[model samples]
Target: MPTTAAESQFDELGSLYEDVVDWPFRRDIELPAVLHSLGDLTRSDVLDFGCGAGLYTRLLAGQGARRVVGYDESEGMLREARHREAKEQRGIEYVSQLTPALAHRFDVVLSVYVLPYVASRDGLRQMCASMARMLRPGGRLLALPLHPDYDPHSDYYTAYGFRLVSESPHVEGSPVRLELRVRGVEADVTAYYWSRGALEEALHGAGFGPVFWAAPWPPGLARIEDAPTVQRAYLRRPHAAMLDCRLARAAE
Candidate 1:
């Protein structure tokens, strides 16, 4: 399968990368929004594509997905994910290679923050195609790509507990540096953004139907005590957005 140019960035990151998931924006907002968007998973089979550290993979199992597979190209991430799986004893599968049996084997494919790593427009479409091939005819894909309208200024998002720094000429595929800021967490990851049209075009070319974009929401369900002031600012300028779409059914 074709891989992203930045795939190796997480290879040696291992356990340290897990801390990024605890960033407040993800804990209170992104996590709930994604799970709510997935709806019921009572008996569904899920594929957590680019499942670094198995954060959501573990949660999917807790949410009652019958079979959860955490697939990643990074051994560093997988090591941490597998360790957690062993320690927690969730029947989740971790794999770096896609076998023939996995094709069209999932009811849902969920990706978080994976899209930004694709190095090119064609690479993005290829990534989508790979995801499509793993789904059933009418399966759903919920991905959290960099919001096409994300603030380019570094400090615009610091109040949300992270920083985004990108150079001028914010065109398609412009590389952005994401810095995670928590008391003990340290992360600086590179990401590339695509325009709305580019995202739609790629998904459609890969056999997905119309895309639905969701803005970041405050944690109304969990209400995790995040200040109203910060919530309002981040809601209005979330650096990431929910992208919900589905693969075309066979009859189409």
Candidate 2:
């Protein structure tokens, strides 16, 4: 059967975001550390922001979470996630990002590769604030933001390969690259490479503390040692700094 136009559009967008590709590389390296950093998440409510295919949500269910909810902006992707539920027979709920009326608070909130799509610095700040707002008191929100160092406006960027560059002491080098796959036409998508420093400030301003830290690919996992054709840094959140807990509150 021929693919529908909607699906085709989605496929293009996915490719732009590297969503069409399998990320066993990232999942293998980051998932364990991300799960471990939660301290004790057993029986806790989990929210998988940008839950592509709900893979993390399903993983959470396997980890003994009392309940899990996956949120994504893509309906096509949600359809695939629903398919997983039927195939694996796992109990998971998928929700639209537009409606928040039935919103449920969570013990842990995590957004993997969701923040950079937000566009502006203000948008990123708003996202952090929203995460803080959704958590219960003392609840943790884990966010993996694309480092700002690899921005196109920066000098460290490469037209074809990845480069590691720094913006400040608080900010470290974010590895970034752009991959041009041969799919008929050349399309370009930019991912903000992340650094440790920028993440802390964003989180602090949003109302969260940094308690743990680890690169998505700390070790064991294959490192794109040469650097990503573009890749961002990983920001670990815990209690390293004070949070503006009221920031998100005031916004509401």
Question: Which pairs in model 1 have colliding backbones?
Answer: none
Error of 1 at 251 (Å): 12
TM-score quality measure for candidate 1: 0.92
- Residues forming the 10-long window of minimal summed lDDT in candidate 2: 235-244
Residues 1-252 of candidate 1: C-alpha lDDT, one tens digit per residue = 678766788887767667757777777777888888887898799999999989999889999998999999988899999998899999999999877789999999999889889989989988888888899888999998988887778898777667888884258988888787767666777888788889899899989998999876754534324555556677766778888888885412
TM-score of each: 0.92, 0.62
Candidate 1, residue 82: the lDDT equals: 96
The residue-by-residue lDDT of candidate 2 on 80-196, one tens digit each, is 787778888778888856255523367777776665445345655676666666666676666655533223433333322223233332233322333433334344444343345
lDDT of 2: 0.53
Candidate 2 vs. true structure, TM-score = 0.62
Error of 1 at 201 (Å): 0.5
